[model samples]
Target: MSVLAAVVRELGSEPVVEEFADPAPEDAADVVAAALNPVDVAVLNGQIPFRRLAPPFVAGLEGVARLRDGRHRYFFAPEPPFGSFAESVPLAGAEMTAAVPAGLDPVVAAALGVSGLAAHLSLTATGGLVAGEDVLILGADGQVGRVAVQLARAFGAGRVIGVVRDGDSRRVPLALGADAAVSSTDVDGLAERLRAEAPDGVDLILDLVWGPVVGPSLAVARQNARVVQVGNSGGPDATLNAPSFRNRGVRFLPHSNFLFSPEDRAAGFEELAARAARGEVEVEVERVPLAGAPEAHRRLVAGAAKRKLVLTTTSGTD
Candidate 1:
């Protein structure tokens, strides 16, 4: 009953390919694809606060897997000893699992799961983003930010602007649905550019890279604008301008995937999966073998990947 898995055999050690007892059907489901994310990388480094599993535990938080009826399903927070990085993993629950929409690739579903849900909920549920309002996405070149840029448009935003690392990184967001993109490195020019792009001020700000951008973004925010902090990829801390935020009457809403209820998660996935199936949203994915997970983790930590990295059961050689 042994199956291949990417196991963290020691603290601070790279995940290695190993054999572990296969999860029984009643307790686990077969995984088809496991998508790597910032949190997964954090878990590996013992950075996730709630993650306390020691060495010998499987690695990965969520993935797309096949259900008993042979349909693809997405699940999150698998049992401690087994995770999504293996051929099979313990199921979180029926509430945490959703059928992949027809025509959506399992790899894409796995890649989009938590990130997509974050974007959808940030704009609609949390930000109260409505039609005819301007939406700004910081770190829009990254996975969830890119998805948020597209979702902002699909959700009927009058304008969608993205803040990327530089001019070179601007095209992807623009092509994905953003009306314009500003460079994050252009610190002095950020406020000007934001004003130029969103003359009336941005109604909602999806702060994916919160640190450096928060201050400048707040300067261009419309009165009563809602800034939803979704990720801290740039850095966990930010020096904010209190007066600007207070004068604008802006609201800062911090978001975590854990804040979403089971019903909300399922609904988010259904909406995003349908969008993917209709080709309205697409994720550029790089396939890697489960054995290459260590290398994948290294590259991801270094921020070297230009596309979504997905690990599958296939041999690493392609």
Candidate 2:
């Protein structure tokens, strides 16, 4: 048997493919899934926050692979070569991790950890989210955004407003449970519709596309509305009116933690598993042989892949 992977072919280029030996069934993981998360880059860039696992390491936070035995299968992360966008990271020791088993495809399963877990924390655990509260999911097509839309539905949100880029069909986010989907694609019309939907202002703003994109959206929130900062794709900095927030009692709550308590991680796994089992969430995926692991990084960086890129490893196979 052989393992497939995606690899970084060159700097600022797309990831390519290569195959390697497969893991014996005895060594293959039974639990199959790699949960993606938003981890900050520490040493280099992408996988910096995960430097604790290994400095100069492959940056992906999650993925899912077929497993055998009781072993778990996930994207193999190795210590990347410092100061160079080189090949695959080292895979010496058994560092494979397992994620919750749900009805989710391997892509969705790989996503269960970071993005899905983030959704669980932002909407349920911290916010005490309940039914009838409206949610505004900005950048709903992205990984975290998609999960957030689904989470809003599970928590019984009264309405979900999906703000998406131009040329994107609203049906995808709508299928994820958004009541109304708007386009940020038309910047001119975005503000009016955003304000119109929130007669009292949106109860919660999941700003994955923060920065200037946040301006018009913030202006429309009602008193005591909460804004959760998840991503800064728009830019790193933005101005906010302190007096306005104080006067309206608007709250800014950024999700600040990645290391879920073991209990919390366990709970999230259970929750996502249930969702996958029910076929509530769908994860689109693109898979490659183990040798292409580097190409996976390249493509991921190039913004060329819409689905989660999966790298198959030979760690556990016949």
Candidate 3:
């Protein structure tokens, strides 16, 4: 059967949806819903280190799919060029796939594939965050940041502060679980503002924005504070002074799904699904049809999407 997929034919080019041959059960699996994530855009733009991918390659990293036997699962990091941003995609190995619990929203499950996993692992595994510790999430208005805020609260953070671009986006993080929200646009006084919100000094920081926010946040971090660099949407470079961090013994952890074992990935998905089932984890998503994937790609690349964007196939995932 023919399938529709978003193809990236050139480096740094916007993906265009086109027809492609469908993969059989032995070859791959069928995607029911796919999410437009920053990794997909980064890979298409040649930011990732995949040297094997050539032109006209499928571009996506995660999706919700159904096995030939009709079992629903969340698929992660399908070997690139045969990614998840399609009406159908190659099945990932059993190690990278997880059964989706009944009653969880398929689109939300697709959106949470990598982002939610990263958040959960960052706090519990890397940060070693303890209940009652003050937690701050930079770029808290973004998809991963939103999940991190909620997860931080669920993990028992005493105070959760979300840093957004402005006051308009503050409500998103607050509603999710943040005790307070601050705007990154508070240029000259950003550090002061954060210090005020976190008078005890932040114990752990989930930093999605690495540019200006990170450096200032580092200055106010408490002794032994752990910082997880999850995303670099603001900019890749972050300034750090050796003497400053040395005094506090602050640690920087770069969290990625690649660091996880297949078993680890599956368990993370299961826990996230369970949280969603209990109404603890919820994703605010913008549903776009599979045919509109090209436009969705365009908007996501331009940072136009205010909410997580999930591509829905004809099977009613929307």
Candidate 4:
């Protein structure tokens, strides 16, 4: 059977919506909503050397789908060549699928999977966030960073500071529960600004943009602080001052969603979904039809999209 999907015909090219063969019968599920993430762009541009896929494959790795029995599930890591940016996709097994919480919007469920898991797990499981401790979130204007700001507050952080790229972007994190929002635009003065906001030093740091901003962020870390590094949106490389880093005894923990176990990922997603359903946590999302995948990819690559984008099918609305 042929189904509509966004197909990547080549590396560095935008995904084109077209009719593609349906997922194999044994593993097939009808897609409801699929999220568009930076990782998907990275894979499309061949930035991830190890996870390369040949052209003519579906475009998304995860989404909300309907099982054969009409039960809704949020599935991850769909079998390659048949991804979630389609009418139907192939699941690896039951292990890759989790039940979406009751009354959760399918688009929000899909949006919360990759970005939400990264934010929630980075703080709890990876950064070892403790109640009443001070937290610092770099790149807090991004999807994962936005969620981190709210999660930090929800998890009982005494103070939460978010560092954003633009001066105007400060309002985003501030509105989302960050105690203070600092701008990284003035790289030279970042340390001074952060120190002013967090005089006692931060206990946990979620570093999402690891460029020149990292040095200033580390400068404000209290002794024995845990720094969870999740992304390099600012840049791939960073230079750390040897003495400042060592003297503070900062524990640099690198985080990736792929490193987490299936059970942990599922639990994290469920918790985030529930919180979103209860209105305790919120993420700015832009809904687009599946056929708009090409334009969405272009916006993502150009860094013009500030909100999380979720592609919805007719099934998703029902």
| Best-matching candidate per TM-score | 4
Report the C-alpha displacement of residue 312, candidate 1, in angstroms: 1.3
Question: Model 4, range 43-92, lDDT digits (tens) per residue?
Answer: 88778764588888888878999877876799986767778889988776
Give the poorly placed runs of model 3, Cα more than 4 Å off: 25-28, 92-95
Compute each candidate's TM-score over C-alphas. Answer: 0.94, 0.75, 0.92, 0.95
User: Which residue pairs show backbone clashes in model 1?
Assistant: none
- Judging by TM-score, tell me the better candidate of 1 and 4: 4
Judged by lDDT relative to the true structure, which candidate is superior, 1 or 4? 4
- TM-score of predicted model 3? 0.92
Q: Give the least accurate 10-residue stretch of model 3, judged by summed lDDT.
A: 86-95
The Cα local distance difference test for each model comes to: 0.84, 0.58, 0.82, 0.87
> lDDT per residue, candidate 1, 1-318, as tens digits?
889999998867778988987887677677889999878877887888877677788898889887677678888878787778898877754337777986888888988888888888888888888898988899999888888888887778888889998899999899897889899897877888888887888888999898777788887798899999888877989999788888879999988767888777877788888988888778889988888998998998888999989998752122
Ranked by TM-score, top first: 4, 1, 3, 2
Instruction: TM-score winner between 1 and 2, please give it.
Output: 1
lDDT of each residue in 1-318, candidate 3, tens digit only: 768888888888887888866766576766888888877877887777843467778777788887677767888777656778787766644338888987887788998878888888888877788999999999998888888888888888888999998879999998997999999887568888988888888889899999877888876689998889888877898777787777899989988867878888788789988887778888888999888888998898788988889998876443
Rank by lDDT, highest first. 4, 1, 3, 2
Report lDDT (Cα) of residue 62, candidate 2: 47
lDDT at 94 for candidate 3? 31
Candidate 2 TM-score to native: 0.75
Of 3 and 4, the candidate ranking higher by lDDT: 4
